[model samples]
Target: MVGMEADGKMGVHLDVSTPGYAGRLEVVEGPTGRRVRSASEKARIAAESLMPGAQVSAIARKHGATRWQIYDWRLRLRLGELVLPESQEPLFAPLLVEEAPLPRVTPKPPKSAPAKVEIAINGMVIRTTVEVEQLAQVIRAVRASR
Candidate 1:
């Protein structure tokens, strides 16, 4: 009989009266061999890992793979080493372009009157809108005349 022992180990127990009976049995633990996956299957799993909001660790666990394997597969896909089937190609909605509205035009305000400056030097008043440099020359000429 094959059964689990009290310590949680699996073992085979046989009756001593059985014919050709073995006195002992050997128990092996863990996986006896590595699992092999096909290229297409790996590609599919790799593509799924690239989906938005898809968790790499969860995808790896679901497909009996490690996170590193998923990442490697993604890299291979990017490098063109792995090709996705035609049906797996991404689809996009048609883009529609519409004409934008013209911007509104605003009327500019009326130009303000030019400011007038009056200078009084030696009781001789001079009123002009000339620039400061020209006014400085005039002031020098006026002072030199006095």
Candidate 2:
């Protein structure tokens, strides 16, 4: 129950009856093996963890990062930010779009029967309609009449 500590330090040794001895349970801040992570550095590490066949869990653990951080980095890459070195074994390519040449669909002319033939009988004029395919037959029949 001593004076207030500005560092907001707290701890828990078997001693709560001590004054100003904030205890040993407080956060230990030092430069021993602790890494001072920069936002960009973390982002880069996280991004790498999401690469194809990468050991995300191992990378995260090594960097003292949560898997969710790596997952978040993947999402951000999708939205555009981080990028892998190469795409030889890529899961997917980034967004690609093309206008498709405005759909050069020159509408074709509607097809129609190439030709037609008509045969008449006397003045009564009974007409027998025939497809263009029979034109040769009609010519032969007329020639035989001569």
Candidate 3:
């Protein structure tokens, strides 16, 4: 604020407090800007976030990180880019399968009745219990005799 201009003019004054002027500009360093986190550190934070009932936002605040960062780390862990400590390998719940009861047996279909044929010709009635082909032959003979 005290330096003179290169051309020997009076020192310039910045009128920053004009109408509709916002507050002075400030550089807010976000999580990515403030520091660099190593893979191991990120893995640790991600593991902590996975604990029962652990909230990602709370974990991020505890480690001075953003929720997105923790989420990214979790994704990396899922993709195998990040590995958990040997003592903390993932655990799967035990499977307990029981034998299911046998399904109900459907009753066998009722036996079908044998086919019977009856023929009437010229006041004579013929009743026979035989296959369709035999019946047809008998009917042809009777017609020929007539």
Best by TM-score: 1
Q: Please provide, for model 2 over 81-118, each residue's C-alpha lDDT reduced to its tens digit, 9 standing for 90 to 100.
A: 76545533444458888766676788755554655555
lDDT of 1 at 86: 73
lDDT of 3 by residue, 70-122 (tens): 99999998888987667865643467999999999997655555458777888
Residues 40-103, model 1: lDDT tens digits? 6778888898877889999999988899999999898888888777766552335799989888
lDDT of 1 at 46: 88
Report, for every candidate in turn, its global Cα lDDT versus the true structure: 0.74, 0.64, 0.76
Looking at model 3, residue 91 earns an lDDT score of: 40
Best by lDDT: 3
lDDT of 2: 0.64
Q: How many backbone clashes are present in model 2?
A: 2
Q: What TM-score, to 2 decimals, does candidate 2 have?
A: 0.33
lDDT at 47, model 1:
85
Model 2: clashing residue pairs?
A: 11-25, 12-25
